[model samples]
Target: MTRESLCRLDEKPCDVELRRRRQDWRRGAEAAYRYRQREEHLDVPYEHVETVGAFPLGRWLSDQRRAYRAGTMTGERAAELEKLGIVWDTADHGFEQNLAAARAYYDLHGTLAAPRHATALDLAVGQWLTNVRRPGGLGKDPGRAQRRAAALAAIDPDWNPRERGWTVDWQRHHTYLAQLLAEGARLTAVVPGVTWHGEDVGRWLATQRRDWGRLSAEQQRRLGELGVRKAPRARRTAAKTAAASGPRTGGAAFQKGLKALQQYIAREGGLPGRAVVERLPDGTEHRTGIWIANQKARRDKLDQAQLQALADLGIEWA
Candidate 1:
């Protein structure tokens, strides 16, 4: 065959390949359109596959994202995807989704101190916040990270508890107490059993007062803003005297056990297993499961008040 004929033969295969690619692109685009119609958004999860025509729409979209990021995507294709509400930067898109959830949480609680398992707007915003608060968790792009941080700060200035020299648990309790105060509740009324959002606010407040000296100056300042003050010297002296006395009397021991049980319930949201050992904030440990068993075993000898306290905590045998 002449050289011209050979060149045409090679060109024919290239043309066929190009046509095949175009057909594939059309099929993918149709699937994407259907997805957007149903979901009202083009933020498909990476592992998702469109059921229609069994197209790998998620993977296809991911490939398109990679191409866009690499500046390899054609202008026509980019425009087409944009028309379908496709977010070119998936990382930024994901951040925005979690940010929406964080905002909803803040609106409801007036704080962003959500627990690690907390969910809002069907998103694991607590975990997202935890991850993003970590160094480099917002990705390696400094500009993008700064923007994300700013968005979070706009919602809650103390969104990162560690940066404020406090734990999320501390911030959560503080927020609850602040809310109660805002609603006109007096500090004296925040006694043990006064709970807010499942937190033992009264117990937490007592702890803060008793251990006020342990808190940083900034922490003390924040608490002071809410009218929380350190325990009086006389009360502290009386506490020390009681500590010097032998092992706690029955009533004292029971109160301690009750506090530990409350802490467990607040943390776990349920009864502790038989093998559980609970630790209190003061560094004391309680064999909570065994204590509960003992209490049940001799419940007949217990006072009415003790029985009632156990019953209040959902103890079946109480």
Candidate 2:
């Protein structure tokens, strides 16, 4: 999240400029709140916006902003925002006011930024109060905080962090889409011209992944942005290829017995179990002795094949 700093009059953000920008503060604030409601970064669609002949004039623009610090707000509100993917990144986004930084903070967590932007809204609110000094010019809070608050409240009120979270969800939605495309690519690579669509892509992306959600939003966003067109299919094929390339694997007394026999050949001129050894074609190596040991265990001693495996590794012999 960006670090937010509030500029004073004629300073970094120029309080006058900040106040000028606050003309549309309600809209911007509402957009931030609305953005919190969405699981993805999508601007408010035109359909959702209700245009009054003009936005209702209100005093929300004048409230003096109390210095914001952590822990003042918590529990339901904090958790709710968290669900909306509102991670208050302690790292600064470098805005010159509390409100601007707040917006940047929300944006870092994946909430959408509104088209109505205020460069230094927080300082502007303070400046507005400064411009409209009453009995004394510019008291702490200028106009009315509630009007802006109301506008914000009016935005996507349905956003419930308990019910839905944006960061993980956005990552999931896009990654699933991307992986599907990647898998398609893989399939096409192995078999040319393989076609795919939403459903097929979904299944393909879902099929192989065991725990992709464990990845962070940045990772998720990266992969999704990369897309899933052909990568998944290629991933599967790559896995298969890797498995094929890996050392041949099996568990058995057979292996142990083979190893023992090879060692026997190394050390002994003759086999202790000649009956087992003699059956081998002259050129045949310890492989025949292993089979012989296994059969003896199965038939004569009625032992399981366990010892044969041990013997195969040359760890032991019949």
Candidate 3:
């Protein structure tokens, strides 16, 4: 064979190999495109495999990322991936995804004080926020962490409850109350059994008032903004108030029933029978079973403290 023909044969093999690699890359790109179409994102998990072609798209993308970072990826290939919304830094991508979830939650609830089990946009946003609120949770880089914190603060200024000298639960309750007030709900109108986002908002509000002295200055200030003040001190003594209010006073009756229920539970080591009656120490006859039933029936009329009293006594419905 002529020398020129031999060189041409070698060139042909190299061209064929190049063509094969290009075809493989195109197939992976197709799979990636499909995934983006379905999920509207290219933030595929490391273990994810595209189902349609059973393609290891995630690994392929990882390879591309490594190549890009190593400065080996061709400009054409990088441009193609970028067009598909590829994010090279998986960690940053993950953070963005979680941020999106946080935004969604804030939009719905008006705050980021989500419970540990809360989910938004199919993401465990509550847990994510909890983690991110921890010291150094954003990342080791100070600038990055600051930026992330700013992003969260944009959603709700009190996104980190601990930083504000309170627990997430307390922040959640406060947020709920603020939301109600903004919606034109009066403080008195938010009584026991009033709930918002599964939280006993009325009960929480009552607790804040009752324990007003126990709260920090900052907490009190926040409550004050919502017009929630310390519960009023009675001018009359308990005995006089009870006597003046009469024996049929709702609070007094509830207390009597609670006392009787407690005594029964202590003696019986369980809930009282629905039909059982018990006499109080003062010889006041209380149909304890019927009273319990009535309490459950009138749960909405009960205040936070009253509900808590029942709950402490093992009343599940409370």
Candidate 4:
């Protein structure tokens, strides 16, 4: 054979072809390179096997694709899937595409269909549905919007978009939520007839402001950016302030016990034990030894002022 016709391994005749095949495989190209290798008896170092005998491979791959679309399947998992010949279209079209699809379906058919693509986008669409429809707007594909459901189901047979997952796209969801909420949109706007925790954004915001400490740091930061500042704590009224400043009942109880100790020390010439302290009180006969013991056991619970009061009496606590 002539130099051009003779395919030499040293000349790397398949290098460019192999690179092209790798690109195709990465893009999920169906043409099998392994089958070609077998047919031609090509001594290619790299072998491509279509199926690893992974049952429900389609669904597994589909979920991974959906995750990649939602921007959640990054890092090692994504790389591992790539190694398995699953290529991810890295550009995030989930929000934009799903939003457009939702708006189109709503505009065309006058009903809301949750995006079957990504959970984050679906949530966003649900939020939007809340705004357009009042108190109870177009309830989710209420007539069992078969066309919309079918379209999504075709992509994923188990396309229960509302079903919760551990790996939710929180950042995307929050960003979309913050944007929609800032534009005077409510959660029910997307999820028609459903109030988040039985309240709209306005009511929720008021409650959130009232219970700011319960919120996470990320939530606080996000809400802060959205101009939802925690309201300053209400100052106590003069009467309330005076009541708070009044002598604690606990101090009085401690003082009564201290006075009994002093009397016992003066009268009996010894520190009061559990028996002595219990016997000193009028209601003491019914009280258990455990209850009397607990008073001494809980010495640390006393306020510093109460401890100081005991210290001034030259009574050392055990």
Candidate 5:
């Protein structure tokens, strides 16, 4: 999700000017809180006092947490939040315990079962399991998986770690849906575009069968802003074109070179100098097409799309 979408989800207005204003307001709030403490001759926790204008710091903190969990927040941003006392440590927030419980349940059942007795925490962990992307999209990181398996085994000694999590379908069951409906929850909001009312459920389900919340063009752009990987459709299209045109020639090679350049920028956290690009993970040797693209971009010759691609990877050429 883009920062705008995250702000929307958190019910905050996304204004660059407003963000600047909030920083000043935050300092004022801290000052006022201290003044009131002295005036009242009381030692009160900062959390207990409501600041003037009741600025939405609580909501902002929650938004930061969500952004961090989604892997969209930068390290600098996280540090700023930490300074404001919004802890981002997953262990302190009980995520480890929750994850371990979910792992144990999966070990026993061999699936992320949506039972009638499932708690919100259970459903949350299941959702995470269902959506968590493996690094590089190559496969599960073996070391991390093994460590998780060991941790789960401590909880349930018979838990087998070798069982593949992907083999089990992670989709919610009808029973889970019925429970959600019974709780007066709006299913459409829970899983976007899937209405689950008395009559519209069937219609909505059929519509979902056709297209279940496929990303719009604008959302695709937003995903780029959020530093999420590009959709498989782009890769598939490139592959098809390559197959029809025979071996990759000038254009295709240039495209690959551009991609490699982007990856290098992302991994290195900057525009690579000629010497640095030579040693970058995906970068080609000096003076190749990828290197030339990097040089052209460094000289500010690329269009907005190319520049924005680099920006999405957190690369600021300057």
Candidate 6:
């Protein structure tokens, strides 16, 4: 959790009781994470460690650390706890400061605050411009937008919205939200701390559905630049663009191997806890890996084919 989280969302005064309560939650989270690692040691799996802190396992690790302290919570619960902990502990305390910076930037530049969902900095500007009728209005609040953008980027810098991963999709959506705000979209009470970015953009755009053709060159330019005309959606457009430019080799290869491994595991009733990928004839691939849960047994049979395949995937499975 972030140090800012040491208090609350509003940067309110966090009393000693609040700190204790927060740390209590922190301890349980840490214990649960320790259960995942087969490593059997603690640099702390991160979930357990509070932000900006050596948290030192605190009361959670004071005694028996062998069991999962938090219980088998849903993936979503676990994830929320992890992110909350990270932001509260590890994140810098410049949130309000940055928000102030962004507000100042917005007042003068005619630039709207870019949403947290923005991908490229330039594209984010374009996304902002697409919503604004005023030419370069986004530039007016460039600093506030920049700060919000940076905040969102910290939420998820490299995550792609079109694909799935272990992380939540909040940051990805936030960027497009800034775009919506620039477009003059009206917003309602956000869900507690939730930031509605992409959907907000869509709603703002809906208000102007009658004036698509009447849009100025700037709007048209942003629409065309963001590829929203044909794609009609920001996330899809970004994915199409990223796919056009992304390295197909590793990503494609990982998917192919991952699929085969999963299928093999399912067929075997469950994975042996390991997998590897190998190139085959006919441009297809083969997976020659073990899924042994037993560590020593798994290592004893680890062979050249598995080793080489793991190397090709830029991973080591020893």
User: What Cα-based lDDT does every candidate model obtain?
Assistant: 0.85, 0.37, 0.85, 0.46, 0.45, 0.41
- TM-scores, all candidates, are 0.67, 0.18, 0.63, 0.22, 0.24, 0.17
What range of 10 consecutive residues in model 6 has the weakest lDDT sum? 186-195
Q: Write the per-residue lDDT of candidate 4 for residues 216-260, one digit (tens) a residue.
A: 776678667776677687666955874779965565565556545
Instruction: Determine which window of 10 residues in candidate 2 has minimal summed lDDT.
Output: 59-68
Better of 3 and 6 by TM-score: 3
Off by over 4 Å in 6: 1-195, 230-318
| Candidate 3 local lDDT, residue 115 | 97
The positional error of residue 224 in candidate 3, measured at the CA in angstroms, is 1.2
Clash counts for the predictions, in order: 0, 42, 0, 12, 0, 39
After superposition, candidate 2 runs with Cα above 4 Å error: 1-19, 40-85, 90-317
* Runs with alpha carbons beyond 4 Å of true place in candidate 1: 1-21, 37-40, 45-55, 235-318
Worst 10 residues of 3 by lDDT: 184-193
**lDDT (10s digit) by residue, model 5, range 70-132:** 998778766654554445644334536566666665554443442334334345654444333
Model 2 global lDDT (CA atoms, 0 to 1): 0.37
Write the residue-wise lDDT of candidate 6 on 105-161 in tens digits.
Answer: 344332333344432322343243233323432235677545544554453443222
Order the numbered candidates by TM-score, best leading. 1, 3, 5, 4, 2, 6
Q: Could you tell me which 10 consecutive residues in candidate 5 have the lowest summed lDDT? A: 161-170
Model 3, 1-318: lDDT tens digits are: 455775877656567678889998999999989988899989877788887778898899999999999999899999999999999988787898899999999999999999999999999999999999888999999998999999999888899999978899999999998987676554555665566788878778889999999999999998998888999977668879768877753587887787777656644557888889986656777899999998999898888888988887889999
Winner on TM-score (2 vs 3): 3
